[model samples]
Target: MTMSKTRSEGSLPVVSLPLPVDVTAPAVARQAVRATLGGLGLDGPEVDDVLLATSELVTNAFEHGEKPDRLEVEYSDGRLTLRVFDSGTSRPKLKEPSPMAARSRGLQLVHALSDDWGHELCSGGKYVWAVFSLARADASA
Candidate 1:
């Protein structure tokens, strides 16, 4: 796997990687996000939330979406954005799984953890993105 970083004057750094479309995708994504967030000097519950959400996104792509392409993690202005790209036509939905259900709560967890989340259709497929506020004060309130 190859990782790239981009930064400009007054712009925050972005770390992106092309993910493998298999069981290892989630683990790979979590590792990348953990290192990236740590390097940015961020920790605490907010960072944990980001890591969990990144895993869910990557897992969804590997299971439901087609040709999971890339994962991007970006931190800017006290906010963190995680996006997963896939060459799939169907979009992710937030569903309320039954309490006894064995699965299908990934998006639900994402919605609860993230300040805002959505998906957008791109040229070949779509990308689902989740945004989190890294400010501890905001999270408490």
Candidate 2:
């Protein structure tokens, strides 16, 4: 994955990540998120939550969708939004895993960890997003 930034002369700060659809994408994304959040002075459990949520989303993209074009991490209005854009039409949904199952828990983890999560179908593909507030208390502990 490659990290890129775009900001107007006086506009919102946006950080965009373009990652290949591969197994290593999740690790790369985590590192990028850590650095970004650290630069923004967000650390401890909150950072951990964001990392976990991002991993789950990225993993899902690779597992269920076509090669994703990018993963976006945006910080605006005191909220952080993580998005995975893939060339897939199906929207993600939470499912109940069987007691003995080892897979299919990514969405559940995301749902429980993120303050708000959803998806939208775009012209070329679908994008799944999870939003978290910087000032919210850590509820995962």
In candidate 1, which residue ranges exceed 4 Å CA deviation?
7-9, 136-141
Highest lDDT against the true fold, candidate: 1
Clash pairs, model 1 backbone: none
lDDT of each: 0.87, 0.82
Candidate 1 per-residue lDDT, tens place, 80-132, comes to 88999999989788888999999899999899999999999999899999999
Model 1, position 116: C-alpha lDDT score: 98
Worst 10 residues of 2 by lDDT: 6-15
lDDT of 2 at 118: 95
**Model 2, span 40-78: residue lDDT tens:** 667778788999998999899888878776887787666
Q: For model 1, state the Cα shift of residue 99 in Å.
A: 2.1
